[model samples]
Target: MAEKSGKAFDFRLFKRLISYTQPYRFTFYFVAFAAIMLSIFGVLRPYLLQQVIDKTIIPKDGGLLVYFISLMVGVLFLEVISQFLFIYFANWLGQQVILDLRIKLFRHMLGFKKQYYDKSAVGRLVTRAVSDIETIASIFSQGLFMIISDLLKMLVILGYMFYQSWQLTLLVLVILPLIVYATRVFQKKMKAAFEEVRTQVSNLNSFVQERITGMKIVQLFTREETEYTNFKEINEKHKKGWIKTVWYNSIFFPIAEMSSSVTIGLIVWFGGLKAAQGDVITLGVVVAFIELSQMLFRPLRQIADKFNTLQMGMVAANRVFAVLDTEAIIENKGAINLEKVRGDIDFDDVRFSYLEGEEVLKGISLSVKAGETVAIVGATGAGKSTIINLLSRFYEIDSGTISIDKTDIKTVSLPSLRSHIAVVLQDVFLFADTILNNITLNNPEITEEQVQAAAKEIGIHDFIMSLPEGYHYNVKERGVMLSSGQRQLISFLRAYVTNPGILVLDEATSSIDSHSEQLIQDATDKITKGRTSIVIAHRLATIKNADKIIVMDQGTIVEQGNHNELLKISDGYYRNLYEVQFAEV
Candidate 1:
């Protein structure tokens, strides 16, 4: 979920956002310059109006009137151009910053350890990377730049008003405290409401993404009505979150409008009294004061709303910064050498746990020589998969070292280590792409011809050719267009194309029918040739031909030997499991 910090105007967060603009520093500074120019133009316009009424129109100076009016029109043209630059450049800077931020955020996520994603939801991460960053863009679009321009306008208006008549200025100052108090209250309440709104949005996204991904389970169990009911509950929370922000907006804007009107009334009543008494305050002076007051306080009223945008951006920045700040990769702080591996793997007394005090692998020591096919067999939760996970360094071991070719795995760079190994999981994930693209995965080095050659070597090239578009076939999202067996064969060719030194097939045949399983088995045998392979499977027949078999019970290996050697001990866990799967063998 998106976490919110308490500070509404976090300078630390503001600085972090500003730092991203370094690449486009000139554009950012130019936008600021535009804002300043807008203030200058805005403040001068009202003063020119006062001049027109008192100097040109009053003394019947028809000849001078045209010149002064022309000057005012020229000023108006420049103001329009300045406004155009402000709006256009401000939004341009915002778009550019978000483009870089989204790219940086994604690159950061790619380096994180698997553990970070294991406990995270796709929807929450998507919300942060997508929508929250959009909200952050408002920091420039409707927030930081506009706020600076408006505040400057307010300052200039007040400066000229004080110079005109100090008495009316004093009267205006009397109601200033009340408006300030109301704005402060509005901002505080709005900050909390906005934070809640962001949180509910993340929750709603998480729920919908997960439910949709696993819609198979929901439909299989006939839970559509029930799931929809649950979704309505989450949706209600999301609606209420927005309603709270709207409720605060409803209460505050009208108060600001009312205060602006009251200030105008006070200015008119007081200036009229002064004119009747024959003071130096003229009609032009009173009208100019009124105009100046509106300029001063109109921005004052809009400042609270813009500040709401600022607070939301800061809150989103805090969330985004938290992800960037996490040092969760368990980084490879050792050598970064891409050495040619012989695939002689050794696990020496390795122990690990996904959570505290719940060890998954308990001091398991095992070794596999180069080019040997090893199989690990275990019941559910027997820590069979953990061995491969630790070997791959997906999860760091708590107490031992896993080494390949006599070098500690942790000492090697992750890309250098993972590049030499290929994993084919039970659920083969294929992208929404053509068969050739999925096989090559857009790697220029692995060409279409190379993929065709590898598929032929693995004996599934004929299967691909049998399809309507032979190699150019579009396997829709998650390879739903292909059968389970076809996807497994594609996974085989994918791994084989890389020519990895080590191959890991985790339950690759678990979900296949007997026919597809046989095809996968043949493909697996061809691909694993001359490579160090570790196979985890429930089918006892698949590992019967392996050089060695490791049987795990809980978190430790209970038996290790060939099929006949293990079957000789009828009382062992291996024999018990083998007998149930291959009773006819």
Candidate 2:
């Protein structure tokens, strides 16, 4: 399990969760009414039994006995109907609330900056959305409702007991303090057990997800025995948590049962003596007292059980709230619209570091004209990709000014700024969707003809058309159904469909075959003709034709000029890179 930060659970999350039920207010109200009615019926049952013994059975009245028996049957029928209605409404409400919260959380996660994903694992997020939400739903639909109804019934039972005979009621009430103390102690133990269980469950989930995702790596390394042993260790930890919870629960139930038994046994002894001593109390009254004694503890037992469930729910809620409380690093508040951009971009003394004192881009200053192709070439970890990320505003600079057409990017809305730029990454990600939908990405306003045009322009249309389903071919998850080159071609087409003012190709053709690479280069040249372009390339041949080539080494520009100008330099980075590529060719 991930280490908890020890932050208090955000109460505001509860308020937000309750707000989801606003749409189903009428249904929830009806469910609550049913639960109340059911509790009232539960309390009335013992009184009816008392009356049956006193009025009908003792007096030997057959008609009255028949009527009382019929009444009991009617009450049972009503109870069943009410139970069904309550269950239906509560389950519906719980499902709706879960759906609503998951949607909101997912949308919020989507808007979060890349940094959040860089630090958080996918397995943890999935657990929050799925298992945690279900746990909270169980709390609301069953645990919370049962607790409220049982408490109400207990109060009514106590009031009636006191009304019947204060002496007997006083003796019973003496055990109340003990019950309360035991409950408090049990609650603390249960909560600790639940927290451990929740942690173990999360760890188990993480292990399963990791094993599935890295199955190939595991198999290739021949670590099946080691992996199985690791899994067993984690599984045992989860089992231990469950075992601790069960142990506490097992001890609690017997103690509660024993306490109730002792109380009832004493009540019978005292009541029996009073009846035999010729007191006003009759046999029927004593029988009713015994029934009421059992009734009183039944709800108390339910309350105990509910408390255990509530503890589990609260632990799950804490985890869910952790995810919901994480404020996105990037947010857009104002409406700063850019109608038509000339694509002039400038980076003024940009300095950035992922962590403090570890600069990635060191006071880098550069500019690109409205329609120039600028290629940035560098070795691994030399900040080539960081420049593109800064321009795209994926990460905010620690101290710098990035502007588009003389307007500071920070002043404009993030979505508005990014909407005008399109990026083609080296590791292309295509959704498990139809080819046309993957290309257009469900942009309803984008026409089929436009999609076809983009695919053709990227030189992937012929390949797509030759498929069994043509444009409608389904690309499996992560484009696993397609070859690496095919997936890259589709990604290129996707960017081309956007036709943004600025294009960023970050080693876009690095993973493709030579034939596909040539085709993509042609398509890239055509697309970048009149747009501001930033090309980060390892293969020098791809960027040799750029209007400007900036060579970087160790977060600073080593040289900057056109291809031939850099090649003429005595011992420049660009010249050295070009020599290596040509020598290999």
Candidate whose TM-score is highest: 1
What local lDDT does model 1 show for residue 272?
82
Q: Write the per-residue lDDT of candidate 1 for residues 192-230, one digit (tens) a residue.
A: 888888889999999999999899999999999999999
lDDT of 1: 0.87
Q: Give the TM-score of candidate 1.
A: 0.97
How high is each candidate's TM-score? 0.97, 0.94
Candidate 2 residue runs with Cα over 4 Å from true position: 1-29
Tens-digit per-residue lDDT, 1-585, candidate 2 = 222433223345455556778999998788788878887887677777877987998899989999989998999899889888888888788888878878877887888778788888778788888898788887667776777778877887788888888878877777767777776677778778888998888888888898987888999999899999999999999999999989987887787888788878877888778878877665666777777777777778777778777667667777876777787567566366787778999989999998789998899999999999999998999999988887777887899899999888888888788889999999988888988998889998788899998777767789999997988999878788899888888888888898899999999989999988988998998999999999988998888789999989989988999999999999877888888889998
**Global lDDT scores for all candidate models:** 0.87, 0.83
Q: Candidate 1: minimum summed lDDT over ten consecutive residues — where?
A: 1-10
